[model samples]
Target chain A: MLKEVTAATFENEVLQSDKPVLVDFNADWCGPCQMLKPTLDKLAEELDNVKVVSVNIDNEDEIAYKYNVSSIPCLVMFEGGAEVRRSVGLKPRPELIKFING
Target chain B: MYDIIIIGAGPAGMTAAIYARRASKSVLVLEALTYGGQIINTPDIENYPVAAHISGFEFATKVYEQAEALGAEFVFEKAVGITDSGTCKKVKTTENEYECKAVIIATGSANRKLGIEGEDGLVGRGVSYCATCDGAFYRGKTVAVAGGGNTALEDALYLADLAEKVYIVHRRDSFRGDETTVNTLKQRSNVEFVYNSNVTKLIADKRLTAIEVTDKLTGETREIPVDGLFVAIGRVPENRGFAQLITLDDAGYISAGEDCLTNVPGIFAAGDGRTKDVRQLVTAASDGAVAATAAVRFVASLE
Candidate 1:
């Protein structure tokens, strides 16, 4: 299972992590976000050098605002405490894997 | 190898699976996105027969479960191309290839874009296609929704409850949706209807702040400052990938009749992407049933 980030642990677990972090900004009621959960779960198991986590934008509004996320199912890739890439909406697993690996 | 392979998982495709599996035919469904197609973006389906006020997601989940329970397999992968070998057809995807005796194409339509200036670059910045997913960010802010159809009307209604102000821009003078919904939207105190205008430009530096719309009849241009822009301007056929192998009309929809028979013998087309006059959710389910019935007959005659 991908780690669910809280405001308390977000800084040490994400911003200061040794590996690149893939953050999923999502909410409970979003349909596309639910559709994408299984894919992210499988991806969290496959990648060795990347850390995957989910942030409930409904609960963690501050983190979502800081990341400038305006949409559900938003994926942001962070490397060295800086955002490297970001994409909005639902994407197939292959496209998502490419988004992270690239 | 499967007896039949359906290329979508929406109302049309899932309904097709329901019919095909009832005929005791082995079936596989391939979908690029999650099931439910464009209808998933809809909040609720108002006119479905026998189902009283069902949300789009609930209806989709029920249909998907029914199909799954009856032994139809579903995979979350896009069918890229089809290779026909008379009796047997091969479907290629980004992940793997599969073999089937018959194929049903129920691929639905994608969201129709405004294609305005700077619209492509503003997707994450301030422009969005789904109002329910992104509307929370624009709370207490001003937003605009483009189009005059049912989806546009619904988007405006959803936004009006959240945003401090909502503007609905349409090229036509009146909405094409139901009269009841139009009346309901007009009742909202913060909602403003901008009729006979088309959104032509997006004004943004890093994120969207304003939009420019041109009056279709008068040629007058007006700028509206908005925190977010939602697009719900109907849909276009998603048949470009199958254009080389199937016959298509001038408008890029698959040229299939009510019987769902395409130019190819073993290939059938169904749903909104097919050449049909009435593109409704019920009509898509009707197409699915017709296409699957035809596919079952074709596969039986093959042996």
Candidate 2:
């Protein structure tokens, strides 16, 4: 299961994590986000070196506002307690890997 | 002569350039406007196969970069005309003329405007032609879609998926779209059908606020508040200049033969500008590949 994080816990849970963290900033009503959830979960399960968490924009306003989340289904990657890469929406599994490896 | 001179840097043109470049052919793409063409204004492309989902701008940008990576040269110039010299073709842009062994016309099409007041000024702001491009921006907001055609229905359905409510304002009493689509839209609780209504004015300054719809039956003018208005009336192919050089259909679209051959030798047409049954991006890309392949074969025959 992808760890559910709130605005209060996002920084500590995702940004300050020891392992590489993939934070999914999305909303429940978004169809594309729903389509992307399974893929994200699968990636988390397969890749043990990475930690995956989800943040609901509707519930977590501070983190969303900080990231300037204009659109939903945004995926931000953090490695060793720092922001590394961020993607706006759902990307192909292979493309996501390329982003991680790059 | 240069191997190929592909007109327009749209998806069709860019794809052709990529293929021709990979085949070691010298490819030059003449573009009037930006790289993406009509697809640039589009927000997202969900129906495009293999991509799953991506913004049309992003997808077109990826194609542009990929074509560039394969060594395709791009020039930003509006093509005025093309003259065939039997063995070679001379493509005349606004600034200069280019001589090439073969040419591919991929000028594509443009969105047909509503022609109502404030329509032109509010294009990207509130009045939009592409729902996939602007739908996400109108999330939880209300929007209106004009026209009753297939494109209009699809746009309304797509917008309904994102927007809180989608009002389909059509001039006719019934939609001319597919029955399944009409049924599906009618089933959607958020979609409202405003029949026999035509948009008289698009009122907005910084962004779209509301639209004045005039009822054809009662001549009643009603103002509906909405954040966005999607116009899906139709498209006009950009083939005015090329019409004098090639055989064009009644609608000013290019008339291409079975092998994507234009009336003029060494000249071919592809994508929405060409005479084809389908005008989807997949088919457009396929047309580009086919046209480039045919042009390559035609060039090889010269030797």
Total clashing pairs for each candidate: 0, 3
Deviation (Å) of A64 in candidate 1: 1.9
lDDT per residue (tens digit) for residues B60-151 in model 2? 77998999999999987889898887887899998899999999999999888888777665654567776764566678889999999999
Error of 2 at B199 (Å): 1.4
Off by over 4 Å in 1: B42-69, B83-85, B94-97, B277-282
Colliding pairs, model 2: B42-B133, B43-B133, B44-B132
Question: What TM-score goes with each of the models?
Answer: 0.89, 0.69
lDDT string for model 1 (A1-102, tens) is: 679998898999899999999999988777777778889999999999999999999899999888878887899999998899898888988899999998
Error of 2 at B40 (Å): 4.6
The model with the greatest TM-score is 1
Task: State, as a TM-score between 0 and 1, how close model 2 is to the true structure.
Answer: 0.69
